[model samples]
Target: MTGLPMEFRAEGLPDRVTIYEVGPRDGLQNEKTVVPVETKALLVSRLAAAGLTAVESTSFVHPTWVPQLADAEDLLTRLDRAPGVRYPVLVPNERGLDRAMAHGVTEIAIFGSATETFARRNLNRSLDASIEMFTPVVTRATEAGIRVRAYLSMCFGDPWEGPVPVEQVVRTGVRLLDLGCAELSLGDTIGAGTPGHVTTLLTGFAAAGVGPERLAVHFHDTYGQALVNTLAALRAGVTVVDASAGGIGGCPYARSATGNLATEDLVWMLNGLGIATGVDLGALVTTSVWLAGELGRPSPSRVVQALSKEQEPDHAQA
Candidate 1:
């Protein structure tokens, strides 16, 4: 596998899959303990050094809403931004966008929901109203020459609303794209998605004239189906995936949510399949292990756990 082209072609999959690292932002936001700003900055630097090209650095939400990321501006300012790496921050509304713009952010993300229940719970608005809220944010970001990525939550299934209709998801996603979002990240917020469900949703999007090139898949491993669903998306021609370091993230408002798909785990599978992600799995595992220490717990990522276990004997021998 060594020396294989970083952009090798794979049947039924893109030549490369862009792994959007969401660890510094999403992963840390939901932690019970507050991670120091210095540590968060170090994590972002380490991730970029490990060959992650696009990392979601932080969110610009109010401190009262997400106290964990209250230092978003400070963190961004402290980062030693790696050349060729893109750091996109999450902006919930126009106000968040204003804050991001002040820091000269070049890329940002806006979030919406496919189900009304989750929309109300997460964004404090109805489904339609949430889209209305993000329209101006997306518009302003685009006008400022910033690339905007939109995240549509609960695309697969909603805990309170049960199974979500595929049509509804497509409608919300299309609206975001129409509002000037460069890409849409369909989120399986509750991790209730299966391979079949993923295929169905992608197919629905296709029918709605939304191709995979403009879409990314974000999955959680609550039921251990994230990777499987990811495979289904790959088969459907999606080349972008959103994952977190150490698989440490969940929606604070969604009671049934769990940690996201680990970047190490996703890279391990992609490496085995000869897929190019430009990510160093061993380095990512090390980063996750260090982050787990910061959180005072073992990483939830299977790849990180197994790799750390494998290194124990070598350390003991030394």
Candidate 2:
């Protein structure tokens, strides 16, 4: 199959895709080492420069729980934000949203769970109670002219309950979107989804009158189906996909959850498909390699691992 690569546009896929970069927040959150605030700031800048429009900068979860992002305020303060880029942050509750508001945050995300077990385990509340909590958060954020995104975890499967129903996911997701969220990111928290499952779920959403334009898919690569499932999603008309640089983060609460669909891998596939992502693949690979050095682990991204080797001797090991 090859000399120099060629481009081919597949049928039924969006011509341009918006990558929701989650590496800075989700990727580093699970790391044992507390990445220096400066390093975090640099990572955000590099990702923006690499042309990701939406880079999730950090989370404002309570320090006692997610200690790694305790320096959220500092990270936000230090970032010299790139123009035309949106650096969104995760605000778990009203207090977190208050802190974000103080920092002049323009975009924020609130994550909820599709299953009752995950709602209790991850959010410390029942599914309905969590929605009760997000109601005011979304209301106030919208009133302040801020944009809010909702994350519905355990969309495909739950560690404790297992095999979540599509209708249940639809109901939970609609609740979040109904609360004034601009979009809803469906999370396969355990990476338990297949291509057929993806089609069925998107169908469920469509039946509920939630079109693909207002939906995003966030898949974990635990079962090696992330990319395939993503293809299924795109075919189902999803233009927004979530990925983390170097594939560094996983669900800290869900033991079996693994790294996200790596940004480099997603970019490579999207590039080969002739879809416009506005990302400089070479620059993104370089940034991810540098981040791997800071984390003291090699990237799980196949593209980064291959390209960095050809970049330079030091970069390959970085």
Best by TM-score: 2
TM-score per model over all chains:
0.95, 0.97
Q: Per-residue lDDT tens digits of candidate 2, residues 221-299?
A: 9999999999999999999999999898998899899999999999989988999999998889999999999888899
For residues 118-168, write the lDDT of model 1, one tens digit per residue. Answer: 889888888889888988898888888999999999998888889899998
Model 1, residue 82: C-alpha shift (Å): 0.7
Model 2 / residue 215 / CA error / Å: 0.2
Q: What are the lDDT scores of the predictions, listed in order?
A: 0.91, 0.93
- Candidate 1: count the clashes: 0
Q: Deviation in angstroms for 62 in model 1?
A: 1.3
Candidate 1, superposed: residue stretches over 4 Å from native:
1-10, 314-318
Per-model root-mean-square deviation over C-alphas: 2.5, 2.6
